[model samples]
Target: MRRLVDRLRYLGPAAGFLSLLRLTAAAWAGDAPKGEVMKHRFETSRIFPGTVRDYWVYVPSQYDPARPACLYVNQDGIQYDAPAVFDRLIAEKAMPVTIGVFVMPGRVEAPSPGALDRFNRSYEYDGLGDGYARFLLEELLPVVETLRTADGRPIRLSKDGNDRAIGGSSSGAACAFTAAWERPDSFRRVFSAIGTYVGLRGANAYPTLVRKVEPKPLRIFLQDGSNDLNIFGGDWWMANQEMERALAFAGYEVHHAWGAGGHDHRHADVVFPDAMRWLWKDWPAPVKAGAGSPQLQAILIPGEDWQLVGDGYRFTEGPAVTAAGEVFFNDPGAGKSYRIGPDGEPAVFLEDSSGADGQAFGPDGRLVSALAKTGQVVARDVSGSQPPRILAEGFPPNDLVVRHDGGVYVTSPAADPREPGKVWYIGPSGGKRVVDSGLRFPNGVTLSPDQSLLYVADTRSHWVYSYQVQPDGGLAHKQKYFHLHAPDTADDAGADGLRADREGRVYVATRMGIQVCDQAGRVNAIIPTPNGKVSNLTFGGPAFDVLHATCGDRVYRRRVRARGANAYDAPIKPAPPRL
Candidate 1:
């Protein structure tokens, strides 16, 4: 009884509130311009799988068949009196002629009468990844374009991200932000009300990630209440504030509206009209990515984005640079090797690469490789004057590094999951020994700037193990030093190739992107690749300041501020890490 009275007091006579939402646009504008509303059902979601959902599309009366209309997507099948608000705004020339999409959460039907249906609201909305974004871009939005208006006018939405906006309340609001965060190229504006930015589905990491990742080109308006929910997931009010603070800290263009109400949509509904104006104030002007944290600014140069160096390969990996700064990479699936010189053009260097997965230059000016198919580590001169010399021939090394002192270390994953991975060291004089063993899947291997420590990426877990390099070419005191972030759908970080810079920052190729960590073993920044997949990276180009990444079937390069620390060169002790 008290709850009902509090709600009545807060919302004030439900009938009047309903009347306020249903009022004709003629109250504000001279005429009430109406739009065509159509409802449909969608069940073919490969991303969410076994989920069926209903959605509605609103085509404004002013829509033209030739010009593509702007877009607004709302969750929970539309709220905040959007149709009337859109009519008033469009009639007054405040917002653009936009096509609106209102969708509901998905549900999977139960096979038996005794079982309850599976609801996908929390799974799709509260989680973080490219899944929901891909669903909208690949599945839902595409199906929307196939529909038509009442008069048979085709619905055409602008492909430009600047012309799109997404909004919702509660979990839907979180989904709106996640979609834009993952793909700024698709949706760049967000309207979040009472967002569930808590630990319901790993959304608690957003505050930390926003402060660490390079900022995307997005403009967001957040709305929450002072008396929101304080459940086991997290404090809604505090999480929204943390999000606002983190966005501001990373230099994002964001706005917020706080109320004294609880976890309901009443406050958000009252402020809905104004939020639209603020979100679309500057029409046609593109939202630009902001200057990121100091850590990101140090590595990513201004106006230097990822540039494609090569493509259409089977699979590119094992990028290494010669002393003169020429870059070389192998396509093991194609059984070929390629080289890129100062001209920035790639050419076939070796006709046959012996199916090598990782390679590095040695102090002796010889290029050494870890051949996966033949289970051998071989070294050869670029001149091809001498045949390849086998350094080791038993374990199949996934990655290897050669130090300035002629020390070679390689990571070899076990043949079975029941066994542990091994790290091997081949001395300068030639015999190889198992320096260390016990990692789940020891992959990419590299040495510190001073060659005093060795780093190896354990792909089966979210850890990059570090070891003290002993004088006798053996590892000692191994520790799970560098922590990494995994995707919401995966348990491991998918850490692969790794390399250290002269500044003692380690760049790791991961599923979540390139996680750059400081010497203290803390991830300071995340730089995602063009295609969102990276296998390996190395410093190359004329000045050795260019970063070349092997991304699946493509290769990309970018100029940066930091210099790569080549293990084959003389070591220099870096400044001590900040505690």
Candidate 2:
């Protein structure tokens, strides 16, 4: 009933909407056991704020309160006769004892009949990002748990994301995938049929992002036909195929069924039972992340993940590791520096850091920093005992890199829009010279492993400029070398800080994640932060194999296959690229 009403929002009056429903017969057959369905209306949402919607709770007759039931959530209020299908599947022992929750998109009531009520379906379903996912986990799911069975059995939903599955059709399908994609720890299995993966919003970028970013543990089944919607937004048929290919390329456990139907639920209705069977095939077994592209495989080590090291900082930045393997990061907003000890616990290293933004460790064991608030560059001892030696000042520096010969290159982006950003090179004698200027926003300066080249991230563009570093502390042969990926919702890559590995690979901290590029400047892989916001990074640990990143208010570290190259150390030529 909620499904029919949701479709009527775009279909005008109820008399006409009822005509479309008559085209299809009731989807269930007598072979499937009749399961009980209860209708529900939801009016409270702190996430959506003042929105109302309806939902349903389908409880299989085989459900016993002895164990918590596995959860299956569907969008757009239950198509495909899911209650009956669950009845047959649970009775046959094909799937586990599950509770299904089908929810409708929220809508805010209008002031009057003539005024248009704001419809949230397209906004909630089509847009990208974590808002919709939060709505499900923080809002809807909690309401579903409050529901009691007809026999007063207390409802319990499994806490594990692996014990959950979600599915939907059309725009609802996109919403379902977004929920799983954003919170894979909460929903592991996805069933998307006739998904609006095209440019209805930023969802069109999913195929590309799925290929570039690290793979997550998800088993997805897609169903679409060739004759689906080819409207102004995008071609549904081609978009679905692209999604399948991207998932396969990323090494996900993906399955697809192609047919000759339209955008309606005709094809999905026919194959949903089979899809459910495959989605829950090997119950009680965990789904593992795939090693999809060789690029991701080259850098990321198996069985290692991003580990939380520190949290509760005002805003963490400037991750630098010492030769002894101690990881240090600064919370410039709080004017403090923290050190991650061998036991992975963070302790305050400096109580007042002058609000540093970028940092690197010198060969003499001092920490060099680009101080943003004081408009100064300074070096200080790792401990809080000594005073900082001022290197340079009077410029608003965003990031900086120190070289083997004690030379420093700093990026000072234009504080005012009317001015051009500049890169200042400080020679060994502490003489400051403007090596380059007129960039939109230069940031995250670093040197190549051999010290013969320099790289700078231009925050206003998708390109990272590379330059030949001359012996006299000058730069030449400047060109846009590394091409980074940006989000569709943003104009720039948001590249913040950069570092080079011993293999000459560069990692740029961007809004999308950390894009790892080879010597030839081609992005090979993207490693995302645990919270989806990455700023500055450096390599740490005894072997320099641990990549530590300053992500917003927290700091995280992940052990990778590659080791880091320190600019302050002796220059070592890395192996040549594969052209």
Candidate 3:
């Protein structure tokens, strides 16, 4: 009886307070102009595989089929009385003639009635990656466009990301943000309420990742109460605050509203009308990507971004820059090599490149290639006029580096699992011999700026081996020098390529991105690729300041603050790194 009385004491005031707020909000929410709502069932999805979902489309009465309507997508089949709000806003000319898409999460039917149905809400919403974004851009929106009104007017959504907005509450809110974050070219404005930004999935990494990568053009609004969920995943209130702080720290256009309400939608519902006003204010102006953290700002030049230099390749690797500031990369899958000249255009340098995996420019201006398919080391002229000069044969090399004196060091990892990987040395006279053996999977190789040390990237481990170069063209005193950062989703560092700068810092291309490590092997900064996968990088351009990265199927280049060290040039001792 005492416990019951205590519950009543709390419930009584809370129920009355919420009811009063709802009564006050109902005045405008009901009096607002109305929009036509059409419902549809969608059963086909290759992305979610064997799932069905229901969706609703809201078209404002003022919408004209002559022009594409601005878009708004709300997950979880819509909340916050969005249709009425959109009706009022459109009627008042506060927002454009917008159409809203309310989509439910996908579900798979069970074999029997007693069996549990498979739910994809958490997988599609809480989980990270670009899968859901692709579904929306490639599947959902295209399907939405096929719909027509009762009068047979086709629904056309604005193709511009600036005119699109997405919002939701709880897990739906996370899904909305994920859609915008992954495909900023599709959705630019986000409105989140009581978002699931905690550890329910990989969303826990957003706060950390947002500060590291280049910012995307997005305007976001966040809302959470102090009394939100504090369960096993994480504290909801704190997570939203952390996300807000991270967005601000990374220079994002973000706003927030805190409240004393608990983990319910009542407060969010009350504030929905005003939130819409702020989110869609100053329409038609594109959202700009802000300058990220100071560390990122230090390396990335102003007004410079990753520009696409080449595409249509199966897999690109072996990015090498020459003294003339031209970039050469190999497409091992296509068995072709391409060169990007000073004009930033890709030209076919070599066809049937003997399936080269890594390449470097030799002291004589010839391109030295590590031929993996034919098990040969060859050097070819830049113009593709002469046949390749086979320097060595019978050993399949993964990556190689050439010294100014014409000595070459190559990494040859065992194809089979049982054998150990080996590093080879070929003297200027072409005498090939094993320099060292026993690395797990030796992949990318490079020399220090002074040519006194050699760095070898072990793909199967999170370590980069550093070796003192001996006078006899062999390695001595090898140490696991640079420790790399691996992604949480994978076991290995996936370190593929490495390059050295004039400041003695090594830029390692891993699953994470180009991790710039100091001389002491401490990672000072991580520059992620736009696609989150980078195989190799090289410094090119007129001043050797542009870092060209060979990502999957494409080549991207960006101007950086540091300059690359040329292996074919005379060695110069660099200044000591900061401790």
**Best candidate per lDDT, number?**
1
Query: Which pairs clash in the backbone of model 3?
Result: none
Q: State TM-scores per candidate.
A: 0.94, 0.89, 0.86
**Cα lDDT, all candidates:** 0.89, 0.87, 0.86
lDDT for residue 344 in candidate 3, whole number 0-100: 87
Clashes of each: 0, 0, 0
Clashes of 2: 0
Residue-wise C-alpha lDDT for candidate 2, range 163-244, written one tens digit per residue: 9999999999999999898889999999999999999888898998899889989999998887799999999999999999
Q: By lDDT, rank the candidates, best first.
A: 1, 2, 3
lDDT, candidate 2, residue 205?
Answer: 84
lDDT score of model 3? Answer: 0.86
Candidates arranged by TM-score, highest first: 1, 2, 3
C-alpha lDDT of residue 241 in model 3: 93
What would the per-residue lDDT of candidate 3 be over residues 1-579, giving only the tens digit for each residue? 343233223222223454344335545355556778999988889999899999999988888899999999998897887888788778777788899999999999898989988989999889776788788888998999999988788999999999999998988888999889878988999999999999998788788777766788999998788889999999999999999999999999998777766787766776676677778888877789888888677678878878888888999999887888888999999899888866889988778887998989989988889998999899988876897898888888989999999998999999896799999998898889999999999988999999999999999999999999999988999999998877655778898898998888888999888987778887666887877779999999878999999999989999899899988989989998766
